[model samples]
Target: MGAPDYFVILAEMRTGSNFLEESLDAAPGLKCWGEAFNPHFVGAAGRREMAGIDIAARNADPLRLLAAIRERTDGVAGFRLFHDHDPRILEHCLADPRCAKVILRRNPLDSFVSLQIARRTGQWRLGAKGTARMAKIRFEPADFAAYLDMQAAAAAAVTRRLQISGQSAFHIDYDALGDVEILNGLCRFLGARGPITAASSRTRVQNPAPVSQKVENPEEMAAALAELSAQEPFGAGRSRSLEPDRGARVPTYLVAASCPLLFVPLPGGPRARIRGWMEALSPGGAPPLQGMTQKSLRRWRRTNPGHRSFAVLRHPAARAHAVFVERILYPGPHCDMDLRESLRSHHGVPLPEGPPEPNFGLDAHRAAFLAFLAVLRGSLQGQTGLRVPPEWATQSALLQGTAQVLLPDRLLREDMLAQELDAMARPFGRQASVPPARTGAEATLSRIHDPALEEAVRSAYQRDYMMFGFEDWRPEAAG
Candidate 1:
């Protein structure tokens, strides 16, 4: 039998990629390199060594390493690429006609649960000398929502990439990965003889029990999962372009606009907490400003507007990075997914399909961040204008053009959140429980060391830097 050129296992973590890779490797005349772009261990890592080159030298340059591996492999050479792997390699594989693409999908809910369990126990693969720790993992509804959205966006991205590139791919779901026919079909697709026997998988399923047993909040999990299933594709049936309708309800917490007593949740801002506190304080509950207009804003001003307005200023780069993490990187099924979908539809930028794993390097993330910034820049320049979700919009734009447009009587720094809360609370005759904001920005920034991306972020948020006096701020400060 003649060997085919090459193939790519386009998949995500905990999505039965190990099983698929091992099964393919078992086939004669087929060489499967596992995670060739993995930053720490290049060229199949612990499983098989490349002929002679030092992997560490090639690790930094994925393109060189892939070329070296392809040259060295004697058979039909292929490599497994998770969504979070080095994007340069992924793009190269996608663009090359010699490479056959195999897109693997899975039930994201199950995969997410499995990943969570594994993360807690520190047991990612099978046969490792580790016992199952029966600790119940705390369930954050926002986190679960983000994971669901991210998985959906990733799956959609794979389809979109294939369609746009016009690449003929062998699509298989994780549930069908163990099937004999599927395995043999993959071999045939690679131009190899079938009847390939299955190999024992190195990765084990962490959660053997039902989903209910693993999570601390079973009801919440079940509800969230159900809601996720019931939802439509990330941005399906919605307008492809970023056109915020005239009658679109602007989400705001009303206190006053003239005296400027209200707080506007600028995407990724602390508007939610402010709104929640307002509802608790008001006798009628947070006022229904559904049809909020200039008229309504004026009325609010006339009634209670009296030197109560204050705005917290988050660092522009930090806010942009936070938006990328929440909306593009770990988006929920609703708004975050919508923004990602719009980016894909309008700018052809696809969010990574893989969940943010601890071991995955920053190359792919930097690519995503750049893409996200590009879309954001476009949105700002486009007809949609400042009518974007707070995450992508400039802080200056959100505040309606810096101090010149809508100057706050009192401007407080987001880093000094406790003081801001205390000041706001004193006016309402209640002490604020200022919970330290749980932004993962510092941890995320640590992995990023690319000068190009750093400059790109700095340039993209230049307005925020200029207006908010953060021009001197560097990523090192966050780290």
Candidate 2:
């Protein structure tokens, strides 16, 4: 009944975080709020009042608000923190001895699948809802790999923070959630007294069966899962150390540039075929930036001075649509759950009333897409927190900083990829035939045919329109 000590539930998506937190909250003299620092969570009026602050103050000075919540709580006070939460709050929480840390983990494969199911069904937690929605997700190796790598990175980051602060944390696993002993152990870790029993988890496991039952590519996923489980020293797979640098732009097959062709890669652009043509120019060699270093990057820059450098650009509306369908609407690891959360939390998009149909209604998808664009617009205007998926980020923003320093000589339109490739080739007296540009077959610009959504897209990517000479985009519905 005094000033309460604090504790955080460090977790990732679909890691039984809700279950763990609910169980912990049920204990006497302990309370763990859900992702208090999450943009969406913070903006909720109910959550704000619970924290004893208004939404504006919470956003303006979250650290103070976080501290206030801890001070105001009746007993042990804490909140859930994801890898993508506000950094300032996470830093303060780790640095404060009054704040205990509980790190939660789950089988990466299971977690990834659960996340996809929840996203597809819009049923994040349990209810009297008669049955769980079953979704058949076509598992792609790349998507799985990316998901594993991302989750691993988030865990490693928290470990690094703990190490820097010389702090130790109580670790819990998703598999241990239902056990009364495990629940009690968590309570004890939070300085609770007396015997505590596990509470019924507020959520249900969406998929309780083998991975093969839900996923199309179960064999590959199983092999990858085995490899991941066998990993020792943890968080070791592909070396993504370079991911922060140049936005994952390691030169592909386009290393040998006859004309100082500095091909700045754009995610979700025509990078694949462009690189393929570069590979055609020369095969059976290590691609550019394959083993690149900071020094090597500088060397390439120095080596390519006075050469023709270019990047391909896609219409912002088209790129956003493609990213939404291919990444967001799909059931896979690459789905941008964080972005979706931000849209709901910060942008005021209403939560869906029911589980999403496997093939979502076109109007529903369009509204969601509009919400995403709204968040992106905020990010473009220097809003922070939610890490915008690079694939859907405005080209103008992605090309800033080091990429900006490399100054592109030309920006090729995606629709004219073939024409642009031939032009670059003609300058060198070599004809390079390239494949046609790729678009989202499942969804297109027409998805957001509403005038309002189209306006949002235009506002979000205004810079792209002005810089790339894309005619002002109006929704087909408007016309």
Candidate 3:
């Protein structure tokens, strides 16, 4: 059989990628693999799972994967493109020039916001062994500024990778392309003509509590949840009501600092089999990295006492806020882990049994971020029994000042992005992490119904912006 002309679709998750990939699948001769290295013995058999399916063995090597890809897609037509978001997928991308490239990017603010949500919600990419790989491989910008700066940094990384390759490719903006236009554009980019339809992007994951539908088959949903829960990475915690924060309370350490912004104490998949592979490829040869087991991670923190070498956590308020906003932006199927479950698991406090709820949108996020500071500040000022560790103040100040101060308002407004610039700015937010002082934004808000107060809401953005090195305002403040 003759080798078919193939195109590779590259981007991180939830960037309208599924819609793009499925468009190729719509063409009669065209076929798309969500994760090309994923089983079905479609490619070379470097490794075999218990089910006897071939999978990519290492993250460092791409020729084997490319060879497998060439071996695949023979005699296939219309369009034979492989879609994936993992950074390791780079090897395969660079390997074959015959395969056209299609790169997708979203607004920096939206993407970072989505990632934060994904962390809390446990929603992950199905492309690269799921979320664990996706998190590590994410090319999004997160340069030391608040969430916004980090987002810009992530965007920039994608741009750099695309430019370095310098291949003829299609670049997509998630906000710009509509369903019909995107699919159609992808067809033209790959030089394949086909009928594009909305059904191509139809997802199997359904909403159980969609507003109008009185669920006729509750049992099916329950069964599915049970099945998913059994395999869940964090496992399931107790169920509770999603009622407004009347009864909800987040943890002190999480809100106050002592953890990185993107922390998940819960383990992902199994322990690392060969961390040495990454070290070999990495500049410093990062030690034989060990993927920790959940039991061990939890136990080690307990025994090590002062030493928390695993599951370093931080940015509860920001992360939780991101989760809330993701719902409004991308209303897909329910995420893997429920929020109440997290409250129970992290704090060892269970909730009363009840139906689970979805994360609210951007407004919820804004409120949460503010409340988190308010709560933490109260503890720090010795209002609550909980004492705010001094480090808490430093981290919060860094986050607030960087995101609000250093960066431009455009980054946070919605859909504004400079991928490369954003990627370069991420390290700033984490630089010199000290407990920062948290002033109560709530007290001021509580007193004023004035529109100027709304303007004040926008003012805090300067603190965060400064960390990212945004705008003309202040390099002096960053130090």
Candidate 4:
């Protein structure tokens, strides 16, 4: 309609969103409120009220504040909405065609590193003095993986909502934040009357150094980033190709520095245990080398002669259940809240509105898992509009994707994982020990194991079953 009644900037932390807000505020007849729906404050940090609505009042009825922002501003009024902000405002804005959406994105690695530095230094913004505090932070692969997952989930949620609603957002990237032409164009999109001659200089770049300089462990950071690039080549908002074929994801390949062992992981398998086993085999129990490219992988092969690459295959039903519990059912960094909501509402999966209650037991979990399996069938076949996550994709398909680059030298079944690993490690004069078995989802699956669940998994992952010769899922048989 008429330039949308107002606008909302859908973004996450450290994405140059604050700079964007400042630029928009500098434009004529355009007003941008800072984090209007941030749970901790009203309009900005340390502020309790906005447009006569206190934090408590805003929490009671967020839409009331939205109305006030629109009514009080003399011209076009808008605000920022982070991924972790109030859900009610997000829901309302996404559905309301009158609310123009502007999405701001940055490299997840940059944002993650920036966020870490910010947390360490407690400097959210910078001035022209450029007298910013600097610190070198260690890069933890596990933490970065979680952060990537969260960013991906947030982007996917907004994207799916816009897609389903048939709405479009004005997308911008962090690098373009300083471009005057792009900022002016954005101002025009927001119905601003005057053109901005220059980008706002109020907020300076806090961390001007390269990522390697800011991180304490450059090698580890490089490895983690390489892994991230291989898994998500295009960052958080990577397009979902419906070709039914995936890339080899070579960067995710793990190799032992001192040993001749390479691990090609199939997501949702016993990756941690495998890593642990591989690490134990390394001299002095060192971590495995990760974040390999095709070129680097070949170099590694040339250097570490006689290296053996291996992959583990878990039963389709067990793998799917693990993915469901970890990535769909539970509320965690790995969980996709949007997908969970869609399953509960659109796919007839009887998931609880929020976290499962203490009373939610085997029966509830079984019913939900069965329903999820039904949806998974469609998802794998491209019938569902959702992207087929690697966590639950058929192992056969994943292996096929891997074969596009390099096939594993050995494929071990989960039931025989420990024995096979021990045998594999024996050549290097080291004995590998498998970690303790997971109990939560495994125990729950065991309690509800039946013919129906097995049938559902078979229907959903016929390729894996046909290729692997897996029988019905037996908890006792699992690794």
Steric collisions counted per model: 2, 1, 58, 0
Model 1 lDDT tens row, 1-479: 34447888888777778767877877877778788776556545463335454566565566676667678766778888876777777787778767888888766656676687768877666542234455578666688688877767866877777788887788877655545566788888886655586433333334444456667887776666557666633221111221121221233434621123555455566555555555555554544233456566556657764546566676666677777776677756533666566665655565544456775457767777777775565444332222356456666655663333234566667666665666775765655344435446556655673566666665566556656767444544431
**Alpha-carbon runs more than 4 Å astray in model 3:** 1-4, 37-53, 56-61, 74-92, 124-166, 199-201, 204-479
* Most lDDT-accurate candidate: 4
Query: Which candidate leads the pack in TM-score?
Result: 4
TM-score of each: 0.44, 0.45, 0.32, 0.50
Candidate 3 lDDT, tens digit per residue, 1-479?
Answer: 13327666656544555645654677554656555443333322233421222444423343455554445543332222222334455554555566666777654333433455456556543321122222221222222135444445655655566667775567766533333555566666665545565323232111111111222333443354355356532111211111111111111111102221211121110012112222332344444323444454445456544332212112222222233223212234632234334333432223223332354333443444454343333322222222222223322332333332122122221112123223322332312212221223223223322343233322332222234333422112111
lDDT of 4 by residue, 1-479 (tens): 46679999999999888888988988998899899999898777899999988999999999999999999987889999998899999999999988889999887777888899999999998864446788888888899889889988989999999999899999988867765678888988888989887666567667644466678898776666677676745332221112245668898888875678888999989888888877877778899889888899888888877778999999988899989999999887989988888888877899998889999888898999999997787565434545567887778778888998789999998888889988777776778678866888898889998998888888777667767889998887677
What lDDT does candidate 1 reach at residue 147?
A: 80
Off by over 4 Å in 2: 1-4, 43-49, 128-130, 223-479
Model 2 C-alpha lDDT per residue in residues 1-479, reported as the tens digit of each score? 22327888888878878777767777888877677888666623246544577666777888777778768767778888887878888888878867788998886766777788778888776532235677867666678789878987888887887898788888977766655576786787787654455344345455554456677766666666666566532221211110111343444314444444557777866666677676554445324334455467668778766556677777777667767666665545866666555556756654353345766666677777777776566444323334445685667656763363456678777666776767876765556567544534323565556667667777777656666677644332111
Would you give me the overall lDDT of model 3? 0.35
- Indicate whether candidate 2 or candidate 4 has the larger TM-score: 4
lDDT of 4 at 370: 93
Task: Report per-prediction Cα RMSD to one decimal.
Answer: 23.1, 20.3, 24.6, 21.3
